[model samples]
Target: MPVPKDNRPLRSPNEKGRYRRAWKESHGNLLLAFAGLIFLIGLAMIWASPPGTPEIDVDLGTVDSADQVVSLPPNVILIRVATSQLNSEGPIRIAVYDSPHTFGNPEQAIIKDSLVPIDGFVVWEIKLDFLPEQFAIAAYHDLDDNGELNRALFNAPVEPYGFSNNARSLVGPPTYEQTIMQRPTESTAIEIRVY
Candidate 1:
């Protein structure tokens, strides 16, 4: 029986050789190119990822000579604040408030505020002035140095902020009552960390 003809285009006698040549020219480098692309993407991902946890130390110096020496009352308490997981972008701003009405407005309710510079990475300390019996603390890593906590359009904080008792909120900053820390002693130290 006679077989059908394919009716394809004419080809060279070394048809296999021609195909090999074409494949080598076009696709042989494709695998290598794809591998290079994958390697580049992986490098970028690694570079963009956050580094491991950091370690930090703080230095507490005497009060500035220019500041007046006011005599604190007997009820005045010395509160020491230690923070962890801090970034080195901006100074750490801490404020103590005596009332809930001023917790939301540090400018109005801040009994005493201090801006501590971040000399190291993850840990730092701030020695607060004499505080009253009832007080709450709010702190943040002001990455922008604007002296205010920055938030997104939805009011989500762009800066890393914390409160006494390490208070947190779902939609906004925590309330003063929620962050109040009371100690029976004359001096106390509170620790806060930011991820």
Candidate 2:
């Protein structure tokens, strides 16, 4: 007998398995090709991306030395700071403030600050660019090398510290006027004893 041309359900229970296997075999290659295309597109996007830029280093304190010349004043003061009873042989921090605003503020009077490392003795001969003016001195022995004076939890100084004219504070550090020391001549020697 000839096969019927009518669109009736021809897949029986036994033929359904063969039909599914044939369908998978035919679409397997297409599915693999689609996945390969997606992988190639991803690789192409990654290769076409721009390279990252290198990091740059910048110096904040850089200045043009050619245009600016540092000239010493005609009447510069040469002050010799001698320390006695320094508990430790570490760096000695000395600060000079010519005004009340810069008295306890080291950042404001940074130019007048000096850090001298004690080499078997405690004496530092520093030169000031300014002429004779009202100035105050605050010195401290940095025993911990932390660049600042270390203090206790109660705000008391843990390191040996002293002010000019041997000024001491009852509750806190000496004020601007109390620690003031005059420079009578071009050069003078001021001795401070660390407590």
How do the predictions measure up, each by TM-score?
Answer: 0.52, 0.52
lDDT of 1 by residue, 1-195 (tens): 333487665665678588779879888789889999899778655543334556343322334578654443343344434444344557776777888777767777645455564443222233334445678777777777888878776666666667777777654667878888764453333455443
Model 1 lDDT, residue 187, Cα: 30
Task: Please give, for residues 12-67, the per-residue lDDT of candidate 2 as tens digits.
Answer: 66887996688698897788899999997786555333234332222212255685
- How far residue 76's Cα lies from its native spot in candidate 1, in Å, is 8.1
Ten contiguous residues with the weakest lDDT in model 2 = 53-62
In model 1, state the lDDT of residue 100: 78
Q: lDDT, candidate 1, residue 66?
A: 80
- Candidate 2 vs. true structure, TM-score: 0.52
Whole-model lDDT, model 2: 0.62
